[model samples]
Target chain A: MIPATLNVYVGLSALLFAVGLLGVLLRRNTLVIYMCLELMLVASTLAFVAFSRFNGSMDGNVFVFFILTVAAAEVAAGLAIIVALFRKRLTVQVDQLDGLKH
Target chain B: MFPAIFTFLVLFTAVCAAGVIVCRNTVNAAMCLLLCLVGVAGLFVCLEAYLLAFLLLLVYAGAVVTLFLFIVMLIDVRGGAPRARNPLATVAGIIAAALVVGGLASFWVRGHLAAPAASATPALGASLKAYAYPLFTAYLLPVQVLGFLLLVAMIGVVVLSRKPDPGPKP
Candidate 1:
């Protein structure tokens, strides 16, 4: 069984990131948008791990760890905000969240 | 065997990631996100980053996705008015995503980036000690800062989500 090359991993990461980007742009639901954001973060983390494995360095792995930590915190805070917004507005649709547009 | 497994994991991750966006139900989208995170963990294992694989499964799949599910259920958000599809935004997004992927693929094809030759040194991500040695040394400051950031996030979530004080009933 041949081992996958670095390019395969990097290309896959790029594809995943692009898919997440498209989701963020196309989705109207706030929660879906948040999930897409996490998807993008995971894509970057995959790239970091792949690079760390290929380069025989700990730096990339360490960065991935930090990214994971930050992502967890971001999700916690972001979800709380989403909940608060839902309570006040009764909807999570981005199109309906135009109170601040004034 | 390894490449085959890697290919399967990559495909699975991509499919699930797309599902997260395409699924209309927020619950289903969150579930897809969970599957995508697991697929990413599998990819980490294939890369020999066992520690990260476990961490990803534990933190992301176990904690984060569950949190999303809880909030989604708690909010009990109803399906609202269908948003009109914005053709202009769709076209722009497609163009931007295509450009980024094409640029990266071109770089890969040009042989501008290559993985370093595998060495005899211990793999950093496979073991906790190996990973911690660097984390506690060169990255100590950043680690400390991350702890502070987590604390702040905790406080912020509590403050933001608490029920407002209500006036006395008439």
Candidate 2:
């Protein structure tokens, strides 16, 4: 019965979100930021699932499944792009990735 | 009994999340992210959304994070300890994190939690029906469109990663 409380779920999701945010802010490595982005995605998914549980609906679960699929395809493509950029630049620092400079 | 599982899962997730951030090595951080994903999947199961949880394991844990690991392996990541010259940033980060968590906990502890309505049982069933009906009928367009998006992204990635054309003329 207590597990059904929305506040508990939201709090945990919020904590995860904060952790991901901190990682994004504090880390200079591009790969670490990418990983933090994944963590953020997971936090959002958790929020969706928790909301679905409270609403007594399964739509959130189905949506999360689709999100997972999208995330998979995304990573495959995103990582390929990251690798390609890294090969050309030799450094994955975000600061150094400005190709539009004159 | 359930409370204990919930606490354990939350603690596990928090630890992994911290690990992902605090670890200096990018590869280790990626691995920690995988651990956090697994913990989140466990939470999905706890929420009784078995299907979502399994897909999370198969797709996110199995495929996506592994792809990340492969990319990390392919790159020549610089080694040596990360510089710790910025103590002020570190202190500010920890204080901000603590304040946010503490405030949320206080709000939750104030007993504003809502009890489920009597009709909640049927609502779950209704939601399933709602999901199924539209999933097969009215909402199929976006679903198919998402598939197309993935296909395009995949093709674009392959093209981007391919070697440049060898033709002499531009």
Chain A TM-score per model, please list them.
0.94, 0.86
Q: Over 4 Å off in model 1, which ranges?
A: A1-3, B104-112, B116-122, B167-170
Lowest-sum lDDT 10-residue window in model 2 chain B? B118-127
Candidate lDDT (C-alpha), each: 0.86, 0.77
Can you write out model 1's per-residue Cα lDDT over B1-170, one digit (the tens) per residue? Answer: 76688778888888998899889899999999999999999989878899899999999999999999999889866656687867887798788777877876786678546566444445668878878888899999999999999999999999999898797899
Give the Cα error of residue B90 in candidate 2, in Å.
7.2
DockQ, candidate 1, vs. native dimer: 0.68
- Name the docking class for model 2: medium
DockQ of 2: 0.54
**What TM-score fits each model?**
0.91, 0.83
In candidate 2, position B11 carries an lDDT of 85
Which ranges of candidate 2 are over 4 A from the true structure? Answer: A1-4, A98-102, B79-133, B167-170
lDDT per residue for candidate 1 within A55-80, as digits (tens), equals 87889998988999999999999999
Predicted model with the maximum lDDT? 1
